[model samples]
Target: MLNLVLFGPPGAGKGTQSQKLIDKYQLVHISTGDLFRAHIKNQTDLGKQVSQLIADGELVPDSITIAMLEEEVDRNKTAKGFIFDGFPRTVPQAEELDRFLESKGAKVNGVIALDVNQEELTRRIAERHKLNGRPDDDAEKLKKRIGEYFDKTIHVLPYYEAQGKLAKVNGIGEIEIIFNSLCEVIDSF
Candidate 1:
């Protein structure tokens, strides 16, 4: 099994590269953001809780997020592996994931951190806003989100790096080029 985690700031192309990786590796793509949005759209009990948190611009509690992931993993264990996107945003969550996978005798094979310049990230996010019409895509929210990512999630990199599972890839090129770079890294692993 080739469980993997793709980590990056918003607009750093994590989603795009995850799609490529999923297609190439036949791995299940578990995107927490997508999961949350789906739950919210369906108005599940958990979704109601998360929706309120999101409305208040607060992070969904890790327990809630992990519960959602646990359900997905339980259902998808038959898959070859998984590509975790936009998840494990904290050290505690990472640790929980480690334990969960350990119980299944599976561990993350790699963590790919997509590195990109902040200016370029902002520009790309602005373009995405125009294209996707997401209400939260404004400059102020984007900057705040980026700042929060660095503040809360940046430390998780070293945790994976110490385990010899973190690979940093430049995220500023053509889509194919960036995807190729990620593929090369994964292939090495």
Candidate 2:
């Protein structure tokens, strides 16, 4: 299985690239953000809890996030592989994911970290906000999200790097260019 974790700050085009990866590799795109939205839309028990937290502008607890991911993994056991986006946002979550994958007799084959400049990310997010009317795309929320990404999530990169599973990809170019770069890296594995 060619399991991959696509890591990057919000607005770094993780979602965009994940779609291409899914198309090219036929991998399951397991995005925690999408999962949370699905749950909230379905009004599931976990969804209700996460909805409340999001409504209060709070981060959902790590345990809750991990549980959702575990459920998804279980549901997709027959998948060729998984491309994880917007997940394992903390060191603890990364550890938990490793353990979960190990139990399934698999491991994360690579972690692709998309490196984009802050200004470019902000610009891209602003453009998205204009187009999508997403409630969480305001400047304040964006800043807070990016801050959290660096403070809490970036540490996960070193953990994967130490395991020799981290691949850094430049995320500042055209969409096809970035997607191609990511594909090259994944193909190397």
Candidate 3:
């Protein structure tokens, strides 16, 4: 299976590009953000917990996140592959994901890291907030989420790099241009 991880900070266009990748590659798109949002919207027990943590801009505990992800993966047993987005935000999470995938006799084929500067990320997020108005898109929450990414999540890149499964794609361009760059990387895989 051609499992892939699309890594980037919030508002780095991971969501946008993931859709295109899903269309072209026919991969199951597992986005933790979307998962959390669904739970929150449904007001499940897990959703209630996630809602508060997200309102506070804290990362969900690995156990909860992992369990949720595994369930999604299990539900899509016949998928050709998976495009993981907004997940494995820490080295431990990445390690756990490796273990989980290994048990299923699959492996992450590669990681694509979108390289977008902080300023651009902030600007794009601001625009997105205007359009979507997601609670987490508020300026204060966005700041914390972005900080959390750079402070801790970005370290996961090195973990993948060490495995020679990391590719960097410039994320400062038109949507199609950036999408083409990402496709080139995934195609190489």
Candidate 4:
């Protein structure tokens, strides 16, 4: 199984590359943000908790996020592997994910972090705002989300790095160029 964690700051093409990775690798894509949105849309018990935290621009606690991810993972018993996007944002969560996956006899094969600088991320997010009209894409919220990644999410890189499972790919280029770069990393594994 080729379990991968797609790591990066906001607007770093994680989502776009995740799709290509899924198509080529035949992996299930488990995006926590998408899962939270679905739960919130359905007004499930977990969604209620996540909705309030998200509205305040806060991350849902690790326990809740882990449980939600485990449920999703459990549902896909026959998946060849999984691409975990927008998850394991903190080191503790990374540890938890490792433990959970171990319980199921799987492990994270690699972490491909799209290394886009803040300036380019801002530009891409701004363009995404105009294209999608996502509420969180507004300038202030974008700043916060990006800040959170720098402050919190980046820490997880070292965790995977220590495990020799990290591949830092340049993330400022044409879509196919970046995807090709990511494909190189995946193909190596």
Q: TM-score: which candidate is best?
A: 3
- The candidate, 1 or 4, that scores higher on lDDT is 4
C-alpha TM-scores of all predictions: 0.96, 0.96, 0.99, 0.97
Assess candidate 3 and give its lDDT: 0.95
Candidate 3 local lDDT, residue 81: 97
lDDT (C-alpha, whole model) for all candidates: 0.89, 0.89, 0.95, 0.92
Error at 53, model 2, angstroms: 2.8
For candidate 3, lDDT tens digit of each residue in 61-129? 999999999999999999999999998999999999999999999999999999999999999999999
Worst 10 residues of 3 by lDDT: 49-58
Candidate 1: how many backbone clashes?
0
Error of 1 at 170 (Å): 0.2
Model 1 gets an lDDT of 0.89
Q: Evaluate model 2: give its lDDT.
A: 0.89
Give the TM-score (vs. native) of candidate 4. 0.97
State the TM-score for model 1.
0.96
For 1-189, candidate 2 gives per-residue lDDT tens digits of: 989999999899999999889999999999988898889989999888898666444568999999989999999878999999988888889999999999999999999999998999899999999999776677888888888888888988999999999999999989999998999999998
| RMSD in Å for all candidates | 1.2, 1.2, 0.6, 1.0
Off by over 4 Å in 4: none
lDDT of candidate 3 at residue 144, scale 0 to 100? 99
lDDT per residue for candidate 1 within 48-161, as digits (tens), equals 888866644456899999999989999996899999998888999999999999999999999999999899999999999999976556777777778878899888999999
